[model samples]
Each structure stands twice: as structure tokens, then as C-alpha cells.
Target: MTDATHRRPSRLPTRLLGACLALALLLAHQPARADDALMAGVHAFLYEQAQAHGEDVVIEVRPPSARLPACEAPQPFLTHASQPVLGRVSVGVRCGAEGRQVRYLQAEVGVIGDYPVAAREIAPGTAITADLLETRRGDLSRLPRQAVLDEAEVLGQVARRPLAAGSPLQAHQVQARALVERGQKVTVEAQGPSFRVTREGEALEPGGEGERVRVRFTNRELVTATVIGDARLAVDL
Candidate 1:
């Protein structure tokens, strides 16, 4: 009745104390309905549905607007850096939300200050198989430099008898086993120690003694020998 009825009852308790302080700051920033931690590992900039693998994202680790450049001989996983970066990182992962109130279940291996990375490379190590995360480039490196049949090199034998391992190289009945160079010489018509040829070439066909004869030399190289008979004519290397 006076002062507009006491300011309409004091504006309804000041709008009910500002609606109870905005509902307690939105329930204290929500997120925690049981907390199983659905997933999180965004080391930095990542969007294609959070690098898809399961995708359900809601990440918020904070503190990496960008940082990717620190792999000098870092050849372990194959790609993380080899040169060319503006902001390097290594944790990266995402996927969470659906039934809980706020979770991020899987994605460990994080450290912007220590460096650990080995939780099975991020979950995986219990007899793991799928070729164990398969990845082969130079695979293990080494054990691939023994196919050097030089000295006129050119071999492809197995012209008339046996030839396994996906055999398929027939040139006029296969016959060109060339290789014998050190001083050069041929003609041994089978027998005992007649040694004298330093080097020669050609005869990449005709197999016997132990089979597998495909030699053709002359700096051409195509060897595959095994037949050490028929008087080899000369073979120093």
C-alpha cells in the first residue's frame, strides 16, 4: 500500500536469490554421474570425429593450443615426426558419453613433462595378436643382401627338369649359366682338379647335380645356381 507495496514483496526475494545462484553454477559444472571416465587423450588439435576409433568424445585436458616438433631418431611407431612440425604431441585419443553423466574411460600415456609411453602403447598387451598391431616397413631390416650373383651375372636355370617356388621363366628351354671370372677361361669337361679359369660367363639353364642353375654373367647378373656338376667349367665367385 505504500512504496508500491514494498516493491512487490522485495522482488520475490530478489528473484529467489538469482534462481539459487544459477542452479549452483549448473550443478557445479556437471560431469560425474558415476564417473567411469569414458575416454580422453587429445594431446592437441584433433577433429575428424576425434581421430575415429570408437568416437563419442567430450575431451577437455587443456594446455596445448599447439606443439609438435621433437623427434630426432624417434623411429619406434613409424610416425610421430621425422622433420616438419609446428606443434608436436603424442597422447591423442577421444570417445566418451552415452550412458554416464561424464566419463572418458580409455586413453592413458600422457605426460607433457616426464615421458613414459608404454601402457602397451596405450592399452594392449595380454597375449595381444592381430599381428600385434601390425606394421611392416623394412620390417626388421637386415638379411636381404645375399642375392648378389655378380661376375657377368645373368641366371635362370631349370630348362627341362624341376623348378618349384612359383617357377615361371622359360627362355628357349632355359640354358644360360654364365659365371667364371677372375682371370677368364673355360672348358673343364668334367674330371678331377683341372683348375685354370680365372673367369668366364653364360649358361643360365640346364640343371642336374643339385638342380637350380640359372647363370648368365657379363656384368648382367641373374644367378640362381645349385648344380655344381657338368664340370662347372669355372666358378671362382
Candidate 2:
């Protein structure tokens, strides 16, 4: 009897088989979901933008419920109207092989920290004090625009409106106390490169520090001066 050898048939050629294996490996190394790639890109972009503002930002990228096709290169960018880069803002993420395919995802970015909040019901015109203000850890994205983050910013400043207890402080709700009163006598000091002059004058308008006020001098000379301190104004000569 002649010896017989059994042979197995190959489903794919050697080159084709190698290609399949390479593709499988590539997919395995990539992110399992397209949203994951998009989320990462958006997080990185927001982090870089926030860092430029001298803030240590904590960001959370909300995942999209809709499924996205697999993409090779993903890019994240801010919308044109998303100015100031604070509070609730939308970020766009584009993903595709060559920019031919693109999908945009909206993510919520927030800064994590202790922000100023009213500890008691503060009446309008009341100066903010340390005892009446407290810091609370919260998401800054949901907070109001121009929210006060530091207590020092509102301290010694008069409230523009009544604030309820536990309410967050906002920049628009506070104003610097007036340093010069209208019709009050003020010292007008003019300084130049080589000379300095001082005269007693009457203020025409109430002004805070660094604010401009019109002053009438003893000689009835009218001049605009910047309030530098209590009863003090400076004019550039």
C-alpha cells in the first residue's frame, strides 16, 4: 500500500492573512469607542486653554448617546462665539480619516474650587465682610457669570443689591465704596516730570478710587482728576 498524506486547505492567502492580523492589532490598540477619543481631545484642549489663564482647571467631557463611526484622527476646537472660555460653554470635536468625516460633541467644562458665597442675608449697600462670606466647593460652569471666586474681591466693597443667605456672590452685585463725595472739598495735586502742585478744590461728582471726578479749584478752574484716596485727587500735568 502507498503512503497517503492528508492536507488542510487555507481559507486566505499568506499575504491576506498577514494583513488581517495587522488590522486587528491596530484596532485593538485604538480606543474602543469613538467618543472616548473625542472626550480625550476635548479635555486636553480645555485644559490647555484654562492653563493659559493661570487657572488649574478640572474638566468633565459629557459623552454623546449617539454612536459615532470609527475615526482615525480626532480634533477638538472652540466655537467662535464661545468667548471668555468660562461658565457653560460648548466644545466641538471632529473625527475622521481625513476631515471628510466629522462629528461634533458638546462637553461641559468646569473649574473645581471653593468660591465665595453669602453666609448671611446681606442688605444692599452693606460691605462684604469675612464673617458674612464663606467658600464652597462647587462647579463653576453652572455658576453665574462674573461670580466672585475670592473673598478679598468683595471685601470692603458695597453690595449693589440684596443677597440672600447661601447665595453666590457676583461681580456685578458689588461696587467699590466711594472715596470722594460730590460737593466735598478735596486736595487736587498735579504732578509733572519736574514739578508738583497742590490746590484745594471742590469735587463735582462722587467717585471711588481710580475713578475720574471733575474738580473746581480755588481760582474756579475746572479740571478732571483721578481719585487716589480719601479727599485726594491727582491730575496729570
> Which of the numbered candidates is closest to the native, going by highest TM-score?
2
Please give the lDDT score for candidate 2.
0.80
Model 2 lDDT per residue over 1-237, tens place:
999999987589889999999999888756556657767777788788765433657676777656656656777777745364665567766666556665665655666667889998999989888999987886666678777777888899999899999999998999988999999999999888888889999999999888999999788889999999999999976
Q: State the local distance difference test value for candidate 1.
A: 0.31
Task: Let me know the TM-score candidate 2 reaches against the reference structure.
Answer: 0.66
**What's the TM for model 1?**
0.20
Q: Which stretches of candidate 2 lie over 4 Å from their true place?
A: 1-14, 17-42, 48-85, 90-107
Q: Could you tell me which residue pairs clash in candidate 2?
A: none
After aligning candidate 1 to the native by TM-score, how far in Å is the CA of 178 from where it should be?
28
Worst 10 residues of 1 by lDDT: 110-119
- The 10 consecutive residues of candidate 2 with the worst lDDT sum are 80-89
Q: Which candidate is the best by lDDT?
A: 2
TM-score of every model?
A: 0.20, 0.66
